[model samples]
Target chain A: MAVLTDEQTMLRDMAREWAGNESPVGAWRKVRDAGEAAGFDAAAFGTMAEMGWTGIIIPEAQGGSDFGWLSLGLVIEELGKTMTASPLAASAAAASAILLGGSDEQKMAYLPRIASGELVATLAVDEGPRHDPANTAASVSDGKLSGTKAFVAEGDSAGLFVVAATDGLYLVEAGEGVSVSRRHAVDFRSHAEIVFDGARAAKLAEGGTGLLDAVLDRAAVLASAEMLGMAGQSFDTTLAYLKQRVQFGQVLATFQALQHRMATLFSEIELMRSAVEAGLTAIDRGGDTRAAASLAKAKANEVGHLMSRELIQLHGGIGMTDEYDAGFYLKRMRVLEQMWGNAAYHRERFARLSGF
Target chain B: MATLADPVAETAVDAFRDEVRAFLAANFPPSLKGKDNAMSAVEGPTAETPEQAAWRKAMGAKGWGVPTWPSAYGGGGLSREQAKILAEEMARAGAWNPIGGMGVMMFGPTLLEYGSEEQKLEHIPAIARGEVRWCQGYSEPNAGSDLANLQCFAEDRGDHYVVNGQKTWTSGGQWADKCFCLVRTDKNQKQGGITFLLIDMDSPGVEVKPIRMISGMSPFCETFFTDVKVPKTNRVGEEGQGWTIGKRLLQHERTNLSGGGSAFRMAGPSLADMAKHYAGVDGEGRIADAELRARIAKWEMDWRVFQLTALRVLAESKAVGGVSEVSSILKTVGTKLGQERAELIIEIRGMQGLGWEGEGYGEDELHSVRAWLFGKATTIYGGSTEVQNNVIAKRILGMLDHQ
Candidate 1:
């Protein structure tokens, strides 16, 4: 493991403790059972905000800790380990979009509220079932926004939506002329399909073609980090089960075939970890964030899906049931895989970024 | 937790980088640029051209060949940061580390760790100076993966040991000046009875028979030792401790085989360029075939991720102060990536990739075919992929040994 700074270690320990104690997998199960009305635990998210996590990526002057992208990734990774359903990743990502393209006045107006957990926000980038960032049918003209955004994570809860339009990113409030209807996802998390008809919208930035791409890249890196945590947790759980569960009078792990499969998953998870860390490091160091983010997301998507499926397959019949947490991971991975950009999407993006 | 790089140290490193850049510009030969300087290919005697020999001599004399080794042992005696600077500078100049072989990669590091004062003085300097070549004698007909089952016997005489055995997959054995061998001194114990010995290849009974590979190259040999007499003083550690020493040496070998030291250089034209050349491109400059483009893109992304993982491992190793099972992980991942690249190259070339020797095929096509064949052996050698997976499962994942 890379040496973590004192602050980073402290942050990780706290996040881990909180995830285990306040919001374990059972907590998520309960939230899932409560349906879309309960959404995520607002109190737990407020606790995270109190811990200065939501402000990790925002500038200090904007009421944030300014701990950098890696710090934010560490928190998200920990939250993901327990399948904790919250708006942390979504809010932080929306904040990043604003920081990237929002004017100073805009930042002053929204960032403090986001940093304090007074507002929940998310980036509505996906317009259809497929992950296409450039083909946004949403548009803003005469200070009004129109078009529908599908698969908007935390959209049901988000007071603010950073909508990707043809021109650029536009800020739309959750009030009049805008509707957010809850969309049931396989993950049982509260995602929403949001439609805006002549909603009063303000542009975050003007004539910056790469602004939304930058925001999406940042979001992708964080999403990759979260997926890495999810994959790691699934692998660990399956490995533990393998050691305990016996078949044919021997522990499941004693079987070489199963051992090799678990080993492969371990290797892939480590690869995703390294890629996610590299992406976070790139963002922190202000390097080639685009390629790094795409690489991380691509690897995470591939590994996450593989690990999720393998977890269920290795666990056998119980894994297929909705009662088992393994299904939750599979469902979560299914959503995250298609979020931001799937493997295919990022692969092509990576190719284009490489000047192919 | 470790702190970030010190500002003063960073400044010193920057200055060192400048110095290294200047030295490389002056000393690195332009003719050697883009030339293959793989240690495995050039280690043995008579393998190097006069140009390679000159480059090796220059690097060895300057002590930059083994930059991190002690100066008393004919090495640069540089710090890790300085060594990294040297490597970066050499890479920037397209200069290869001329002094590399089994000696530098496996034997040298192991000897430095376990060798006695006399052994260090005798062997370390020679290896540092790139004056002698060494080949490992570990695998046997019965001891491929189960290495401790080796039957190469060495009877301890008063002054010398009489060794009689055959070692298979002895890489570069034909030209190696010496052999770092494992011989079973006692047959009762599987591991504890083994001994590690250094033997002269010119010893009366030592013989090497080349093994023709699928690549149509004889890079390996079956080495026979028929009652060869090796001196008692040449033994590396305690007789029974050979297993430990051997494992340590394999660790070094695996690390070297993983391409950790020289990963920055692109071996040839990238997959994108190959695609553009052969598969053609669309108006948007994308590959004409969508599926091929997607596959190439996936491979390229994987390659980038592999490189990043390698860097992460390096950084983590520095902070943690030891290499974990990650060397095994790297070995598995690196070889697969290499093999995948070769596969992609062959796929991109189409019919030309199938050529062995023909008038129509270009040098790149022929080389790609050869590389593809050679790539198959990469997973088999230096611990096969399955063995590595087992190592990872047992060591890193805390799985019980199935065997």
Candidate 2:
């Protein structure tokens, strides 16, 4: 972990305690059983906002504490441990778009509501199966926007959409020409396919052409933080199981083969922690977010994939049962691995940014 | 205004940079620009030219060579920020620290931790001045991986210990002025039987024979002692406390050998430029060979991960002081990656990378081959990768060993 200020330390501890007490994985089981279309508990998110999590990255002028990215990542990571499902990451990302590129009118209309959790906002960037922000086909002409966005996380509940267009970003309310259809992917989160046909749009005109990529970078870092949380939980759970689970009259952890493999996983997780923290720290420092984001997401994808798989295999038979929490982590790991950008995508992106 | 939390005001930092520049301008020889100190744990000390001797004396006296060490013991005693500025200024001036050896890398810190004030006053100043060379005397012929199995005995005399044993893989032993030895003080106990003793190489019964390595370098030696008398006061800590002190020193060694700090830090041109020069690049400026390009990309990304982890571990260690189990991971992965990078360099240059001791190969080319060979010992020494895994598993991950 990076060196934490007293405030950041308190925020992290609060988030951790809250997640453990109120929104454990069992809480997600309850939400799943209820079949909520948004894939998360709304009341819980309101609780998060009341605790000042929603406005962690927002400016004080805009009704937020502007605590910064690393601080926000800490809370999101804690929530991630319980598999707490919410549009917190998406909404924060959308708020970044507004803060970076939105006009004063746009900020006044949206920032306060997003900070208060009265509004659900998200960036609608990808138009295909994979995340390719550079190939965005969304177009804004006249006072309208039109495009079909694929696999938009939290789209079903989002009240405001920051749609990426060929020229720039456009703010589209979830009414009139905007329509969202829920998609139940493997992770079973609140993902949607949205189609916009001449939606009333407000162009985010300030930060220029780089704003879309920059916002996507923020979203990528957010997703990476979530993956770090999941990876850590999976690793811890698997380790505890290894100590208890017996094989041939010895605990699995006593076997040198399993022992070394767990050691390797420990190293991998440590590396992942470093990468994710560095990404968050970069954003906080206003450094090169593009490289750091790609690096972070790439390691998160690889490590998350490795860790969830190991969590299953290390547990042997009990891991395959739906009754066990390993399957949830595994499924969520797959979905998050593909969100924003996968390992291969970010690796290539990092290479390009590094000039190969 | 410099605060206690971060005492690096721009003006103060700038002034330190200026001080460093003036020091370098006066001390560093123009001919030594871009020249680096050879790995002191490996190569024997060469005779220095007059200018080189002068430069070493100036930097050693100024204590800039070991900048973060305590100034009371011939050290610069700079803060971390000031040390960093010292490094940056040196890099900008193309000068290197002339002082480094096993003493600075491993022994000094450990001794400072566990040594008596008398020992500190005796040994540390010489190390800070780069005046004396120290070699480890831990690994014996029978105690390679299971280091505590070492059988070197220190028979108790009235005022001194008569040591009799053999130690192998004593790096720079032939050139060292002193050896920090681990000897058996009690036969009844295994780890507790060991004692940390300081032995002078010039003692009558001490002998060192250089062992030639696969890299065609005799960097390591077999050291033997036959009733060598070491003063009782030379023993560090308690007699049975040797294992603890020795292990603590190994921790220092492990951290230093973990690539970013030292041992495997390769300073030269980048691997990509070599790839482009030797293998060629495509129209898009990517490496023309697709497989090689992918492999290079993987190595590069992994290398970046290691670097980020290094930075994280540094921050973490600073926040919660002391080295972490992550340092074990750093040693394991970092050494392996350093070897991988060396392999990549060889593959990039192909035949030019395999030269022995002849013309047609540039100094850099020859150095890469030798470095690659010697780097194999990195994972083997300072606790092997397998041992590091056991540490991570048994200690960090709380995996129990089979009884």
Candidate 3:
């Protein structure tokens, strides 16, 4: 297991306090209104970097923590609870993949920059709105690349892009070979569609199917961990609302029907929590992670999606309105549900990896 | 908990296994394999014979009545792991428990935990020798689910308490020699004034009326206790401690009833075995129906998960001992899987499964149908599915119903 030591716990606690104190409830609304290209606080990012939070997943040789995936997952979970939009998860997860499968030269070239937050990168692997990496329509040739990558996360802002081509993985500059077009996701996050036409690129690794699969598994697990944080936030928000929202001469929490629903939802989240921990620990322990990652992602997709839907329904008409923050969680969950893979994809993958 | 097998303890376990296996080989008649009906040795149709009684007496005299209890208390005194190994070896040897009436399954563990020294000395020996049978009297007609509201009253009469109410759902009461019951000794408190009392089944004014179930067999009965005098010394724990004792006793009862042994020792052809037997080998030696095969594959995956979970709990309990609520979760998931597996087993049988009679269909097929019918009780008994879910809510999630 990648141990989250006392120091990591303190870092998370500080972030949680900031989320409660500094971050306003309508922070995202401010971003939407101001039309500032999506961003987080520079001072807070500096504080995190000084505390070495930015290097929480990087190797020691690259001047980072190297505590591994579980610790990084915890950071993501805490950050997600605040709905703080940042490139931490994307950068760390993508950087970990580079460390795992990229050659020594690749690591020496990019790891330090990513660790210092000087450059942010994200994995662009969704081929045609589906989660199948093998169905890549993008191809590479002679250090030049030509293909379009759909659903590029934070594409408008990211400095570097890790693109999966038919041959293997290729690294391309954000604007040189790639033309970024913004699209409004359900969560209202900055997503993009990128078209690459015979643009200059560098191939990172070739014939690294096994290594790439392992990295993809780690990415899948980290994505689930982030979703778990969203689910927790949704559950707590809905529960607090139920306790305060009075109806029929008593609080809505008093209704057995609602209590039962919340109880079932709580059980689902707890099970998902354990599943996520198990998956992360499997990667850290160097055990069979193919099955564990699929189980975690499947559980997160199913339970996270369910919790989002329930949170909205429980809040009644106020939940459907854009003015309410519950709608944001619901939207975020929808985006996360389709991020790495949805429930059905993970279930089928779990069965296949388990030798079923 | 990491448990490297102890070489010394492993030797002891293996020796005990060999002894039990040899005895079973000599004693268990060979005609009972794969017979689900024969699994319940207590309910078998074979008449009691002198040889069978002699064999039982011989086995009982060795203090192996339950094999897991302490020798000082008339038990086998083996370690918990050894006891489990003994049970497994005996099951593998095809020899049913020679002494597994209500006494061993329900009362033995409770008596070990809560019974007084004198009570243990007097009762454990006779119980170990299979000389006495015990039946539970906790569930009353008016208190099935809301058990704490039982109205069975016991009036103090100087030295003895006169129990004057009734208990329903007393399993195996018709064959039991004694009944352990709960009665209210004080009326002022809701659940605080109860007392746990043991009384002879043949006492005056005692009546047992069997309640027939859907299976056509009366596994339980309604036991009436009108003016039945139980000695004050026979009361377990304190006068007001009955509720606590009863709850703890029920935990053990549920755990033992739904433990891991049954999951591993399910009868007749397994679902996979049957699918293979009936469907025959495909072009690549696979099952024919892809959907059915996929469902079975999922079930198998879940089954392995449950087994690993069960083993984890078991190892934890062995290392640091206590009655864990984790058992309730196992019971909930395990019983659901068991019921689903039974349904799948029947579906795999197909046309020949329709034959309930006739010698054409093998004995295993008939047993499979009976097992399918019998498996329905796995969820209903040992606290119903609804009860289990509530336990999961209250105990695990800490989510009590809002007042």
Q: Pick by lDDT: which candidate is best?
A: 2
Cα RMSD (angstroms) for every candidate in the order listed: 3.0, 3.0, 4.9
Higher-DockQ candidate among 1 and 2?
2
TM-score of 2: 0.93
Q: How far is B72's C-alpha from truth in model 1 (Å)? A: 3.4
Of 2 and 3, the candidate ranking higher by lDDT: 2
The residue-by-residue lDDT of candidate 2 on A1-356, one tens digit each, is: 87899999999999999999999999998887788679999999999999988899999888889999999999989988989999999999999999999989889889999999999999899999988888988898898999899999899999999998889888999999999899988877888999999999998999876788789889999998998999899989999999998878999899999999999999998888888988899888884589888889999999999999999999999999988888889999899999889988888887777766
**Candidate 2: where is the Cα deviation over 4 Å?**
B1-25, B60-93, B112-125, B229-233, B259-266, B321-325
**How do the residues A80-126 of candidate 1 rate in per-residue lDDT, one tens digit apiece?**
99999889889988998888888989899999999998899899888
Give the count of colliding residue pairs in each prediction.
Answer: 0, 0, 0
Model 1: CAPRI class: medium
Superposition error at A1 for model 3 (Å):
13
Candidate 3 C-alpha error for residue A318, in Å: 3.1
Over 4 Å off, model 1: A1-3, B1-55, B81-95
Candidate 2 local lDDT, B1-403, one digit each (tens): 3555665576677788889889888888778975555754576677777777788889889888889889988889999888988898888888877889899999999889999989999999899888999999999989989999999999999889999989999999999999999999999999999999999999999999999999989999999999899999999999899999999998788767783474335467777778889999899998787777767777788888888888777777777877655767888988888889999999999998899878899988998899999888878998998998998999888999985
TM-score for model 1?
0.93
DockQ comparisons of all candidates to the true complex: 0.61, 0.62, 0.19
**Candidates sorted by DockQ, best first:** 2, 1, 3
Among these predictions, the greatest DockQ belongs to 2
